[model samples]
Target: MTTDGCVFCRIAARELDASVVLESATVLAFLDADPVTPGHVLVVPRAHLPTLADLDEDIAAEMFLVARSVAGALRQSSLRCDGVNLFYADG
Candidate 1:
């Protein structure tokens, strides 16, 4: 499932080392390498897409759903957290 030039795809495929937090059919959530907060997770689609517009609707939806689940998990975890901020840019 790893794509040649996409780092996220490689991580999704487990070809790259990432502190994975959660994974589903179309999504992979992992700890950010350089995080601003303790439980900062990077939720990504398994598809090799550089931009949001390039992602399929189903995959995009799955990514957000995974993000929500990860956020809930983070909040429940020992990490001190009150809220979650999910951000993405089209380009």
Candidate 2:
């Protein structure tokens, strides 16, 4: 079963827990509950929506923008990473 609420929704609400790395009015970045590596993170929107088709187009764009911003920051600040890879698991 999924959690008592939507996994993404609860994370958006801050009702559930995840190792969030970055957050904004439209997006949130957190670690994978099941992670492949130490640096893995998941970015999402604040709105409660099951899929990208369920969200507004602008919201989707904003989410992508936030994810890109995080990547840029990581490239600038992280000494170990040459570049960041963002993989959206749902896809």
Could you say which candidate leads in lDDT? 1
Candidate 1 residue-wise lDDT, 41-70, digit = tens: 898877777787788889988988898899
Candidate 2: the clashing residue pairs are: none
lDDT agreement with native, every candidate: 0.84, 0.74
| TM-score (C-alpha) between model 2 and the true structure | 0.74
Please give each candidate's TM-score: 0.87, 0.74
By summed lDDT, the worst window of 10 consecutive residues in model 2 runs over: 82-91
Provide the global lDDT of candidate 2 against the true structure.
0.74
Per-residue lDDT tens digits for candidate 2, residues 3-79, read: 45577878777788888878877889887899776566788777665565767988888878888887776677644
RMSD of each: 2.2, 3.0
Q: Best candidate per TM-score, number?
A: 1
